[model samples]
Target chain A: MKHIESESNASLKQWKKLHSRKEREKTGTFLLEGPHLIEEAIHSGAKLQHVIVEENYQMKDEWLKERFSLWSVPAKLMKQLSETEKPQGILAVCEMMDQPEDLIKPKGRYLLIDGVQDPGNLGTIIRTADSAGLDGVFLGEGTADLYNGKTVRSTQGSLFHLPVVKADLLQIIGQCKEQDIPVLSTSLQEAVDMRRASEVEGFALIVGNEGAGVQETLQKESTMNVKIPIFGQAESLNVSVATGILLYELQRNRS
Target chain B: MKHIESESNASLKQWKKLHSRKEREKTGTFLLEGPHLIEEAIHSGAKLQHVIVEENYQMKDEWLKERFSLWSVPAKLMKQLSETEKPQGILAVCEMMDQPEDLIKPKGRYLLIDGVQDPGNLGTIIRTADSAGLDGVFLGEGTADLYNGKTVRSTQGSLFHLPVVKADLLQIIGQCKEQDIPVLSTSLQEAVDMRRASEVEGFALIVGNEGAGVQETLQKESTMNVKIPIFGQAESLNVSVATGILLYELQRNRS
Candidate 1:
């Protein structure tokens, strides 16, 4: 283990740059903080490039002696590296495991997201998909960056548990259709009520933007569009919450 | 209508104090920001005591001429009173509609929250309960304050649309039993599969803390404890998302 006492360390500079999307994409790696997420990454078999811990931190797990390098950082440096108000005294750098679009399997429950702007909402949706046993998550254009701190925190480390593909959702929808996997889209306008829509197996549930909702082109390409009935005075539900209800419903009634 | 230019003004100071829970509780009012929520408040027929706007702001709705008093403040003052990163040039101080505990109707779908800590999660649960047509929200001990800015914002003005009561979970459970309304407590341990729990006409669903799950006494007091089955590696779901799924399932399958 090496001690990184100053931010001027070349390794620390490269780690700090992982905070940016462009740098993360270029290097094919992202930074993670907190013990829960790092532990989760370890369990998910993510390639842990480095694990940075607070000085004299007694935190030890079997994963410590694995392929990942270790660093003991000063409290000040740890605080500087943390995005949250309260630093949890642990951080890790993990390589992104983005799969090629063609590698996406035909038979699996999946979530396809488009233009979800809020990191919290996107992360919650991903976490929900993970809980529902969805096989993968596909991020369409305009969605929040998968490596965003808020998104990562919200996912609670589910990103490491499933396949994440970034590609044109339109093409993905077509490919699913070719493979006989239904592409189910969520819509609030001109759609069949969700409860009435027939539940399906081996499908991809598509959720869209927070405000404008699923794009017209995407909605048209979907095998079917469904809406969760709003029986109360409130106009609508949050996108993440709506996705949760829908994903669980899909699982609950599977024949 | 009044023009208040100075932050030092006694009334402005009083208004600013509403940011604190103690002050909001003492004054029986709370601060609200953004045009959408303010409009929702108006639609819900909430008593809008004061509406503060940015100087020369073009935000003119016919509700402006209603019984509410008005003040035009400077940008700096608006920023001072707003908790969000971007102040929407509007803020309102409206009385809280805390009903006497006895006024809770005997028959209506309800949500009983116990110790949900995150402001955003608590707010989203309340909003989902509203969208699910739940009549009232009974907030038990340890729940985040409804007047919290993040909580209020996450609710998206649902606070104005329903009765949110903060009371003892034990007493509320007793009252629910007295009325013969099923008190369904959510649990992660020693509970029936939620999918198998029969739907009810009028019932109160109890959800507990994000980490602790439902309290033991509350769980024992419930008519039946139920759990959302987890099919994946995720240990648990976010409290708000879990509540959303439960409420919708309750609503969706009602006879």
Candidate 2:
């Protein structure tokens, strides 16, 4: 196994750049920390560029040893490259997968996010979408970067399970209309009760920013606007919670 | 309106003390920041010791002005007391309400957490429980204090909407039993599919730490063990996400 000890190592410099959205877009790769996430990425058949394990922490599993390109780095160096306080001693660089054409076509249940800035919220929504067996997710402009470290961690490694694509909302909505997929945007005002709304077979449920509901433009363009009935007096549900409820409702209705 | 400008003022020292859980416990009050949260707290009828608004922030809303004891402080003072990047120009000192009796008796549905250390997760869970209309929430030992600034922020002001009490696991379980509420604990190895599990009209769902799930002792004591089945290959759901799914299922079953 190759060993890296210098903070100035070329690969380390590249990993540092992965911390930013611009760098991730430029390289088409993202850094993932911890053994659990790394293992999940490998198991999901994600294209991994390399695996870095802290030199002091050796992998006892023969499976990990046989399957991937392994590199050892000093513990201090690993900490510098990691996002968490206690580095799990394992990290991976994985190539970004292109959104599948079949998955991207508007069909079945999908989540459309507009300007959902919280990385954790974005990741959780993706994981929930996958769990609910949604077809895919589309991200509109100003949404959190899909490959952010916090987003990856929040996904609990579900990032590899489903197709998540970033696209212009106007274009995607137009395509959905062409494909006969209903565009359902969630809003607080002038929205039909989510429970009472018809659960069409194929629909894209759109969620928006925590502070703001869906954009006025998107809301105006939606085929149907629905709101989750709030019996209690909460100003609004968390963006991810709203997504979970809507996804669950869609799954329930379809089943 | 009362105005205080000095950093070393007695009230300022007390406000600074509230930044720690120990201080909150000793004083039987906690500090809440941000306009939205403070507004929610007021709406929920929480007893406010005083509200400190930045001098430049005009209180045009008669409702906020009429209800609470208002104080004005310099912008710098508000910044010093605030946790976020930009102070929202409002902060509150609220008297911690006595743990409500209804919260101790598990009725309908409830959530019990054990050693959940992440403030964000704890806050989100509380908010989820409230939205789902759970009877109450019990914080097991080692969990992050509910009064912490991050925890308060995370609740999105939902902390004021539900009864959250900190207590021992064994005692809480016994109380649930006395109230004839089943205790359901989540685990990977022994859990049946959560969707398939019968919903108890009055029950408590226990979630454990982020790294380690429900403690073995608590698991052994639970009346039912359930798990959310994963269709995809993600390692596990975030604690808050898992809680959301379980609570959603419970609410779904009820209706």
Candidate 3:
């Protein structure tokens, strides 16, 4: 273990920079806050560069002490590095996960995210897609950054469990077409009721921005546009909740 | 139209106090910000006490001018009373809704929320319940205040569409039993798979805290405990999304 008391320490300065999306992308690594997310990363065999903790914090898991080098920093410095209101006294620097070499396969279920600006919604959609056993997620232009602190926290560690890729949604849709995978886009207009959507062996479900449904171009490109029926006065469901219902309906009968 | 430039105007001072939950409860009134929500309130026939707009903002809906008194306040004052980052130059002071005189009816579907602390989750759950056409929602002790700014905004005007009551979960469960409505408590322990749970003519689905889940007491009191099976590495679903899935599944067969 090494002790770093100054805020200007080189490692501390670099770790603090991870708070910015640009910095995380440029460095090819992001910070994981708190013990639970760090433990999940470890369990998922994520590539971790270092584990940092407050100088007075005790490591509860003995294996963690033996497996990784620990950097002990002052409490104030730890707080400076944490994005949350309450610092958990621990953090981990982990490599950005690699997109699966084969982004989509025949007969595989997938989620195509389009311009979901809310970090919380984006993260929950990923977590729900994971729970639904989706093969992967494709982040279209304008979606929140996958490594955003709010998003990572919202995913509740599922970010480590599945493949999430940032790519041109149009290209993905084209590829799915080639593979005979149906692309179902959610839209408020010219759409079939989601209940009537036929389940297939595989699909690429596209859900979009908070106010807008799927972007017009994507809706036009998809095999079909589907919508959850609004049975009451609510204009629409929250995007994340709608995604959850769609994924559940898509997988329910298949299982 | 009444023009008030002073921040200390009695009405302006009173409206600002609505930002606090205590003030909202004490006065039995809450503020709705933005044009969309105000219009929704007007359309829903909610008790709108007054409409306030920034001095420079022009009222587009001519009927709004004829139907209610409008107070024009300074832009800075409007920002002070507004919860969102962008104020949209308008706000409305509305009376808190009255719970339905008859709380629960025979064979009516409902949602019981327990200890969901996040205002966003609570609001989204309420919106989902409305979208699912549930008869009403009972907010158990420990759930976020319905009138909190974030919650009101997250509901996206759905707050005006349905009946939401603050009540004791145990008592609500007892009422459901009397009405022959099965009270399904969502739980992780010794719970039947949610998919296998039979669809009913009416149900009272109780979802709980994000972390601790349905309190032990409520779970024990409910008619049955149900769990959404996780098919992947994620541990659980976001409470709001889980509520959406449960509601969608509960209503899908009946619709």
Candidate 4:
């Protein structure tokens, strides 16, 4: 195994660049760290560009040895590349593929996040959407980049399981309408109880920003406006939690 | 307003100590930042030990000025006291209150987190449990401290609305059984679909850790084991998202 000792090494510098969204877009690659994430990424069949492991990492599992080309690096350099406090001694560089254009076409149950800026919330929503079998997720302007380190980590490697596309809010809404898909937008005001809202066969569920909800124009064009019922003193549910309940309820009704 | 300029000031030192769980417990006080959070705490009538504002912060709101005695601190000191990259110019010292004794007596649905450790996940679960109108939340050993800064922030003030208590798992389970409240625990294996599980008039929904999940002993003692149906390739839902869906389903079924 070839070992890169210096943090100033060319490859190490390049790896750090991938942490930024612009660099991830420029290089068409992203970093996956830790054993669990790397294992899940491998299981998802995401193309592995390179695997970097510390010199002392014991590869007791024969399966991992056979799957990829491994390069050894100093533990310190690995820590510099890792987002976690304790570097897991294993990291993988994987190619980032654009979501297929055909799949991005409005179909089945879709989620559109408009300006949901919290990376953890956005990531959890994506994971929930994937678990509920949503067709795809559309990110409107102001939404956190899907490849952000926190977002990727929070997804728990679910990013590879679903198509997440960044698109214009108005444009996507129009496209859904053209495809005969209704847009069910969640709102705090001017919305019916989610349970009582009629479930459309093929519709898109739109979740909005944390502080301000779905935009006025989007709400005006929405085919249905729905809200989760609040029975307690809480002013509102967390955006991600609301998305989870709405998606689950929609899936339940459809099934 | 009285002004304190030094980092070594008694109140500044006390606020800094709130960054750790041990300090929060020892002092029986926690630090809360941001205008919205401070407002929520004040609205909840939680004892306010002190309110710190930057000297440059204009006193724009009459109601805020009337509510508490405000102390002005330098911007540098305010930054030192805040955890966020951008401090919101305000911080509050809140007195910790003991869990309500009556919370142990179940009246409606409740949530029990067996070993959730992530501060964000714990906070989200608490907020979700509150939104679902659950009776209370039980934090088992190994769970993140409820008063931890991140957990408190994540609750979005729902922490004050819900009766959250920490206890011995076995004892709490026994008490629930004595009250005739069924306990439903989540598991990936050997669990029935949450949808198919019979709805109990009064029950407890138990969520486990993000990775290891509920301990075997807790699962065995549960009245029933339930699983949220997953249709996509993603391995599992985020713990908080799962809690939201499960609690909502239970609430939906009962309604």
Candidate 5:
């Protein structure tokens, strides 16, 4: 373990650059903050390159001291590296797992996200997918960066528990079809009531943008488009909440 | 209709002060920004005391000029009175609905919230309750203020469509018992699986703090304690998502 007291340090500069999405993508790694997330990363065998902590923060796990490159920085430096208003004094740099095209299997439950622009919403949806025991999550183009700080925080460490891949929706949809997995798309018009949608063994549920229900091309490609019934005056449900309800319904009625 | 260019003007000052919870509570009114919310406010028959817009904004609704006290302020002043990153150039001063004690009926679906601290989560829960056609939403102490901007935005104007009351959860539970309405309290321990829970005609579901499940005293007072089964590795669901799932289950199984 070493102490990093200066922001001008070369290593500190590189760590600070991880805050940018371009830098994260280039390095194939992302920074996640807080003690719980770091612990989760360690437990999940995520490739954590470095574990950084504020100088005053106590090291709870003695094993972490020797597990990876440990660096202690001043509170000012920690705050600069953190995205939240209240920094938890610890963060880790973990390699983005290499996702192969075969991450999705023939018999699996999956979530296909298209154009969810909010990082918080994307993270919550990922977390919900994990909570529903979905086999994987495929993020289409225009979705928020999965490695964004807010997305990491909102995920509550569930990102480590599931397979989340960034891929093209059309190609992924084609793959699901080839594998005989029914893809259910959520839509606001000309769709079967979600409650009455037939149950399937292997499925891919597609949820879309906040304002636009789902892209027309994607809706056309889906095996069926389903809509949750609004029993009251609310025009719509929040995207994350709606996804949760749909996932729960899918799981609840699985034959 | 009047035009005001100065932030120090009396009405503009009062509108700016509505940004704070103390001022909003004291005045029994709240400020809502954006065009959609203003339209929702008008359509819901909510008491709109004042409508303020940027000087450059075009009035699409001529009736708004005659319906309320319309004030036009310069962009700089409108920005000062707005909460969003980009002010939509229109906002309204709405009187808070006076919620009567008798809002809860003998046979009606309802949601009881306790200690949900995040304004966004609280608002989304309320919106979900509205989507589920709950008759009312009773907020217990420690919950976020319903009039908070984030909470209001999260509701997406569902706040205007339903009766939302600030009340004591224990007292509300007592009333449910007296009226023979089933009270379903969510709990993490020693609770029946919600999937197996019987359907009901009219029910009140209680969801609690983000960290803590429903309060013990309130849980003890309930007809039954129910738990959503966790099918995955997630420790728990986001409070709002969990509330949405529970409400959906309640409505889906309504006999």
Candidate 6:
């Protein structure tokens, strides 16, 4: 274990920069807080750079100590690195996950998001996608940063379970078409009843912004558009919840 | 129209008390912020006790002005009443919605929540239930206060559309049993696959705490236990998203 007491410690400065999307993207590294997420990352075989722990912290998990070195941080310094109201005493600095070559491959269920602005919503969508056994998620421009703290926390470690790659939705839809996979978009105008949607072997489901449905261009490009009927008066469902329903319905036919 | 300038005003003090659950319960009133929610409440025929706005704020909606008198407050006082980071210029203090007489009647889709601690999750569940045309939602003990700011906000005005009554789960489940309404609980312990679970016309779906599934007592009491299968590495779904999926699937059989 290495002790770091200074406020301006070099490594601390680098970790602080991980808070910014630009810094995270440029460096290809991010920070994760709490034991649950860290343990999940470990189980997923994520490449952890180092584990940072508050000074005097005891290693209850013997495997953790043997797997990675601990950089002992001052309690105050650890607080600075935390994103939650109550700072968990430990964090892991991890490299950006590499997407598998077959992430965009045909014959698998996938979630395609465009400009889903809320971090919590985006994260929940990713987690739901993982639970649905999605091959990967394609995130397009204007979407929340995959590394945003809220997004990471809301994902509940599913971030490590599946590939969430940023790409153009139109481009991804084109690829799906070429691969003989259907692309579905949610839209009020063009959408048919969700039940009427075909249960194909492979398909990509597109969910969009909280305030807006899928973009016009993307909706037009999809193989079909479906709408979850609002049987009552609420204008719409929460974006993440809507995605979950759509994903579950799509998978219901598979099994 | 009324002007409230002093922070010590009696009504303002009462409004402040609404921030607490005890006060909201005792007074039978709650605060609502933002134009969208306020407008929704107004449209839902929710009794508007008071509509407070910035002194210079103007009501362009003729129906709003004719239906309810406006109370103008200085910007600072309005800020004190606001909960969001960016508060809309208007806020409404409305009467607690009356849970309809036939809320638990035998023939409508329903949701029963047990110990769901997150206000946001509870709110989203209520919103989704409303969207699915659920008759009413029975919120049992240990669940987040429906009047909590986060809960109110997340409901997205669906709060006014449906009856969300606080009750004891066991008692409600007993009533559901008597009414011959099928009560289904989500469980990993003794659950059948959700896809195979029969969706009936009038069923009560019980969702529990984010960490703990339905209470053993409640689970054992349910007519059936169903689980959403995880086809990937993730262990569970976000509570609200799970609720959304359940509500949609259950409703799919209806309309």
- In terms of lDDT, the best-performing candidate is 3
- Please give the range of 10 consecutive residues that has the lowest summed lDDT in model 5 chain A: A59-68
CAPRI-style grade of the A/B interface in model 2: acceptable
lDDT of 3 by residue, B1-255 (tens): 899889789988998999999999999999988888888887787888888989878777654654667899888888898988988898888888877766789999999999999999999998999899989999999999999989988898888888999998899999889999999999988998777775778999999999999999999999889988787889899999999988888777765
Stronger candidate by DockQ (1 vs 4): 1
lDDT of 1 by residue, A1-255 (tens): 899888799998898888788998899988899989988988877888999999988776676667888999999998878888898989999888746456456777878998999999998888888888888888899999999888999999888877777878988888788888888899887888877664676888899998889998999999899888887777789998899888888777652
**Candidate 4 per-residue lDDT over residues A77-165, each given as its tens digit:** 88888888988788888887567775545457789999999998888888888898888899999999888878888887778888889
TM-score, cand. 2 vs. native? 0.88
Kindly list the per-residue Cα lDDT of model 3 for residues A1-255, writing each as its tens digit: 899988789988998999999999999999899988988888887888989999888777654654666889888888899999999999988999877676778988899999999999999999999998889999999999999999998999999889999999999999899889999999888899887885667999999999887899999899999999888899899999999988887777754
Binned by DockQ into CAPRI classes (incorrect, acceptable, medium, high), candidate 6 is high
The sequence of per-residue lDDT tens digits that candidate 5 reaches over residues A144-236 is 999999999899999999889999999989989999999999988898877776467778999999998679999999999998889889989
- What is the per-candidate TM-score for chain B? 0.94, 0.93, 0.96, 0.94, 0.96, 0.94
Candidate 1 regions exceeding 4 Å error are A100-107, B100-107
TM-score of model 3 relative to the true fold? 0.96
Candidate whose TM-score is highest: 5
lDDT of each: 0.86, 0.82, 0.89, 0.84, 0.88, 0.87
lDDT for model 4, please. 0.84
Put down candidate 4 lDDT per residue, B59-134, tens digits, no spaces. Answer: 5574364456688998899999989899989888888866777565655678889999999889989988888888
In model 2, the clashing pairs are none
Looking at model 1, how many pairs of residues clash?
A: 0
- In the range B31-126, model 6's lDDT, one tens digit per residue, is 999888888887778888888889887766654654666889998998888887777888888888887665677676789999999998999989
Q: Choose 3 or 4, whichever is better by DockQ.
A: 3
- Candidate 6 residue B157 Cα shift, in angstroms, is 0.8
Give DockQ for candidates 1 onward, in order: 0.84, 0.43, 0.88, 0.81, 0.87, 0.88
**Model 3: fraction of native contacts:** 0.90
